[model samples]
Target: MPASAFDDLDSYIALPRVEALALSPDGRRAVLTVAALRKDATGYERSLWEVPADGSGGPRRLTRSAKGEAGAAFTAGGDVLFVSARPDGDDAPEAGQLWLLPAAGGEARPVTRLAGGVSSLAAVAEASASVIVSADLLPAATTLEDEAVLRKKRKDKKVSAILHDAYPVRHWDHDLGPADPHLLALDLSALDDTIAAAVADEAAEDAEATMDASTPYPSSLPRPRDLTPAPRRSADVEGAALTPDGATLFAGMRRSLPRGSRSILVAIDVASGERAVLFDEDGVDFGEPVVSHDGQTLAFVRRDRGSAERPFDAAVWVCALDGSGARRVAADWDRWPTQLVFDADDTALIATADQDGRGPVFRLPLDGAPVLQLTDDHYAYSHVGVDRARGGYVALRSSWVESPHPVRIDADGAVTPLATPAPVPSTTAKLTEVETEASDGTRIRGWLVLPEGADAATPAPLLLWIHGGPFASWNAWSWRWAPLLAAARGYAVLLPDPGLSTGYGLEFVARGWNAWGREPYTDLMAIADAVVARDDIDADKTAAMGGSFGGYMANWVAGHTDRFRAIVTHASLWALDQFGPTTDDSEFWSRIFTAEGMASHSPHHSVAEIRTPMLVIHGDKDYRVPIGEGLRLWSELAEHHADDDGRLPHRFLYFPDENHWILSPQHTVIWYQTVFAFLDEHVHGREFVRPELLG
Candidate 1:
């Protein structure tokens, strides 16, 4: 029997992530927006696809585009309503106009004109009576970028350099502006051979992509003409739900002030121009508030937005239509409750959870333990679609071990595969799992993959594989980059789920919080030790490499110990403290790490103590860990190299147009080739491949 095999360095380790899923209320049809492959050398082109509820039927192509096709929903008249990025006209990142198509396949019709991009939409009902749409850049979403635009217009010889230094982003990445979004309710009251609708007075920023937070209605629409005025200020109005009775609209709230969360719900009378705050709280926070089908209950996800480590362990909750009998259904559950839907009978709740490496589906009652296992195999199971007629269950899934695809889980729990635009290749490289303990007696689960032809006792040069998502797991199969590429290079690679990796439960992930540089670092060191102890591995020839969280850890490893001869860090975090103010989550470190913790954990603060030769890579537009981390580390190490011995060697590889994750196929191949050459130089005692530079 073949042991669970592993890859040297597979691209599957860092592939694209699928974000949204929608099933037609009828069940026989489902639509979803799969994330584009990171590289997209061709440019962003994500679209809507159709699948049968049974999972045995082929996936029918519904929508395709060059820029992107996201935010899909089913119209009341049994048609597909989606957003697609138009080409040639504008390169607006958020410019997708709303379009409608019959589920059985017919010409797609443009529902309305969009000044920007459509971010999301809410169907009035499966009957196709009316609809609510959201597009950022619609008037309501147009933010005042006057200052920012003016600054750009004023040219300076040192402008590019200055912008680069201030933003820590590659100049090539998409220019982000003060994004705006709007939500508009459409009146499809006409659906025969034609479609008719009115845009609410202003658009809603329901989709955070544009940062607008009000509903969009054209002047022609009745609701927006009188009293239901558009919102003027920024508010957290993310996530919306349709009441079964179809009379009222609901939205959740988020705040950036004294708390990241607030107990606020926006209740709009869909018919009248009147609206009211369903509820507001100072201590309790609300998010993902969903209006149930019966129209009597409002289901939502709630958590306390505080500095506490477990600020958002959201549980499923419900409230009466009249705002009475409020109670939580599954709040204390450890997993991050994602994609919620009431089952066909409304007797059970199906939720997507990151309990394991793959996003798995779990079924829970209004009050009880969730069914342990619902669907397994494939990358993950989420984006649930429920329709009582088609047995009412569907999911969109993808994983590090497998490409993103759709699957159907029956009432009997048998998962049948569905179709996807980009099907996972039929073949798999190989995978295996081995468990080892770290220095602190904590157990570590690691995988070892061999070159295609080489195996036991082959004495292959070793590539130490690592993963980001410090709170997430480093599992096997379909992740892109790192391991996939390493494996292709014909080296032995090993990946370990260090102490704080997810799927192991709550305590495991929480351990990574303030202990950033400690437990995780220790877990990595122990992997090298395990490899050195094995006879099949050559201790004299070994390389350390990783990206993002893994990259940061690799830097720390090389700086702290010389057990490995070569190191490469990509989109990596060097200074954890500097990460907050410049990153999307500017306040994260302030909450997770205090001044002392930041100083104690940052790799930049400790790099002078490193002895290993290194290669640093960063994308110009990466706002996550940002490019500054990579630049600073490389410059300091190089500067000190000139002053110290000739022993230390290091290089910096910057992707001009890339973000935290290198997406272009050309850049990806070039990156892999460069790092492999670097590893060859030190581990094999010679640069085996000439490094090719991309212009």
Candidate 2:
């Protein structure tokens, strides 16, 4: 494919991608979720695909449904188990439910028919047939049938009300409750045996039912027992892994604290309803638990809450199964560990961390040795599946230049491609790494994408794109804020990692902690100045854009300087005090920020100083930086410029159904088109072009 082909937003969104890889027990086969455009090209649909662990043949599609299949896992017998919303021909609920595909390659059939439907899946290591599923339950309903009846009653009454006692009534993009996520365990050993015998009996009675059937034969499915009993309000368990013996389950559980909520590792007895906190420490958060194959050792990531002087630091900690001898591993490693997994023999750990300019995989030894850096590339890896039997691992690798695909990495640090669903469009621009020194002499770095025709004589307009997460880095590929799309439009895109970005050590992050307008703001300006000085960049045509925390910075930049021609802030925080009290996870932020700090740093407090045209974009369902922020920002901009005689050009783009991100394919196209039009009008002195779809 020519690089120009992907220059179109439609073609870019149509690219086939894969994520969520799960390797089988014997390391002979793996399954992953592949997302492709639906038939009408309106949106993407995800389906499960299987590939060989030996990296021989291409991936084969396993399940196809309108609802799509995800959260894939392999059972002990090598059968594939996944969650889907596909309706059974009969009376199945409309939510996601567990389905099983036989190991020998047959029809995928429903494994569990719960009322709330399965949200995620986990299998017992020692007993592969045993599985645990998470589902939503009404506040008082105890059983699946009761929950189903309650849902029906609510539907019949057309009621949509929720009662909450907590400070937060919603999450990133959704309401927190009427129902809460609950975990249930299903011992499928007896059901599997019964189904096998029933199938044999059916074959003898009716040959047609045993052959070419699209669904599994009707058999009695077992009732899953509730592991998280009632009375445990507001308890959330996720990332659960069963022990090798299947006697205990270790998972990350979030419990309420005085200030907020903190995640801790909990060990639950598989048979009894007893649970114990395995690792708990004050001023710390623990999660992502991985147990060794022998079930003797546990490895998890521990994050130390930041102090007034330091930022948050994450490190891998290892402890015995009995919750003793807990010690930090690779204490000197500067990078924060994520997506951790234990090797088969339990001697070492494989994990991914944001490092420098990329998210790289690292192998950390349990004996406190230096961490080994594996896979030296610009791409980032996630949903890693290890094949200890084959002495290798498979992960979904992605980069700014390409979408994610499944790749295999061997012990010798060799990366082999496993599946290629679609061709990556050739780029119309080249990516280069650029660095500059902050005001404090601290080194700052970022990626610069220069357009195809950009040069000394024909300079391109620059877009200073700031990443979200004041805590995250722009090290991975993002379909939402793609740089290639901007490059194709004859723009040089600058993705800078300022203060509070990961990959950099805690000290670097500390520079911006509690002080949003200090180092991070200066560092961004320093990098922008460096980019503008380049001969290939048109400094006068530069514009600034950001989302979330980046959005907050954009607002800050607008209030502090008139350097940029225009500014775009999406889902930004306008008033720190209002945002802190109303955001979905209020507790978490309240614990980290003080009222005085909020008032001092909030951009809304200094709105009168703004002197630049702006485009404000927000989604109504964005609970993280909620729609209120955008409303307040727009109001402030309007009220401050009421006497400006309409000289300042400002527009507001709103999404009613969308959340923090503009995810709909059609909506995303409009988003980019509108942004380009706004930039052209303000920065290039071109006429404003309204999006046709919006009209």
Candidate 3:
């Protein structure tokens, strides 16, 4: 790839991306899930690739099919297991099924044939060769055969309606339907016996009968036993961990409340299918369970669901397998762990958490010692897998300047980049830090991405970009909201983590709790002030933009100030009062604000004060910040600014098929095109070039 790959949207979109990493139990091999643009350039197809865990050899593709493969894991015997929708034989189901590739090198075979298919790998036992996978099943299906019959009947009748007995009928991007997720256990150790018996019966009739029975063999792995039976909608498993012996499964299950839900940790006996509550508390939720190497203890995160007054901090808690001797570890640690896994010796936990403006790995000792920072770099780590036998870790790390790639982290905190098939694209943009003191004496910090030639003589135009999650921090590399693309267009992008952004401790988030318009807005203005004052930034040519919570802030900025020449808000909350009842999870937000408090911070009330030209973007399928908010914002903009003929200076870009994030490759290209075009017209004083694909 050329060095200017980031300059062209086509080349940028075609770049291969690494997503997930999995390590073998022996700590010798690592596998990654890499997604590349399809031939049609409409979407991404995921495939598994093998990379050396010891950082010795080049990456090699492991599996290939038109349907592709993902969710890779390793069995105790070193075989690779993945989920794919590829057709197996004449009777193969259309949904995704588990497939296994031998470690000794041979053809891959289907391990499952369930009609509903596997959703994700829940847990894998290192010693027992037992596997647990999550799958969706219809409410009435009592067995795998019954599930297949029910699915076929539904397809034959073309029935698409779903009856809802719960509060949330829709999730972030998809509808929660007649089929809910359930955990299924498969004993891989017993697979050989089942196949042998089937072959014996066939040989009894014909002495020369060959065992060529298709991809799924005459006998696939014995029908998976349903561990979570008739769980309805409450079987929402947040995280799961299996003992090394595969005798017990600790899972975080959601307990549905009258309006909302809370997660609680539970332990299930894998043999008898008996369950017991491990931990449960009011106003608190537990998740991210990880078992010790010896299976004697469990460590999980306990989160307090704060009320309308203050924000809560997430703390790490450890307990015995029987739910006794529960205690919080590293109680003074202010940062929140994004991912957790027991260290090789089981004396500590290897975790990644946001600190300052970067996400780095840390080691938390169970003895209550101070947390030790592991990776002292700018990269954020995820999909961490421990090499228990060898005493190291394998994880995928990325920064603002680099895409996610696998790396080996030694026990002494040294990071070695592993060979990856998806090479990191080169960019000319430079990254730097910027900070300022807020009005309340709090420090506000952010990242400033500058173009190559930006200097005192040639200042680059600025785009103030806010992040979503209101609770999340701008600490990691995001392919969807990359600032490097903006830098390629000769623009500087400001990524500010104002109030309510994590990693700054609970007090920083609490400062903006229930007061989104006060501290967060001012903090953003403070950082913007400090950045614009620099000699390398164009103070006059500036714009503001954000999505989700950041979009809400953009709308707030537009309503309150006219400093920026233009504004862009995507999937933002407009009328908080109307948004309360219409959102997907009304209960969560409702708990954070009173009716009066919501109306006070609402941006729709101040729409008449807006004077800058604005561009509003939304997707019809966005459930978090629904399209109704966008329509309302657009309608109000027209109502307040339209002339006699009902025309206005604002524009609305709507996507009918997209969700909260513009996921489609083609759609992402169009999104950037429209955004830059709008900024060109208002901020750069150039003619707007409409995206050709829109026509």
Error of 3 at 502 (Å): 0.7
- Tens digits of per-residue lDDT for model 3 on 240-285? 9899899999999989898878999999998888999988899988
Candidate achieving higher TM-score, 1 or 2: 2
lDDT by residue (tens digit), candidate 1, 595-666: 776788888877678888888898888877778888778777876674555444777788888887776656
How well does each candidate superpose onto the true structure, as a TM-score?
A: 0.80, 0.94, 0.96
Candidate 2 — which pairs collide? 3-426
RMSD of each: 7.2, 4.3, 3.2
What Cα-based lDDT does every candidate model obtain? 0.62, 0.82, 0.89
Clashing pairs in 3: none
Q: List residue ranges in candidate 3 displaced over 4 A.
A: 1-3, 193-218
Model 2 regions more than 4 Å off: 1-3, 122-127, 192-219, 231-235, 307-309, 643-648
Pick out the ten consecutive residues of candidate 2 with the lowest summed lDDT: 211-220
**Model 1 lDDT on a 0 to 1 scale:** 0.62
Best by lDDT: 3
lDDT per residue, candidate 2, 462-555, as tens digits? 9999999988998888879988888988989999999989998878888888889888999999999999999999988999999999999999
After the best TM-score superposition of candidate 1, give how far the Cα of residue 72 lies from its true spot, in angstroms. 2.3
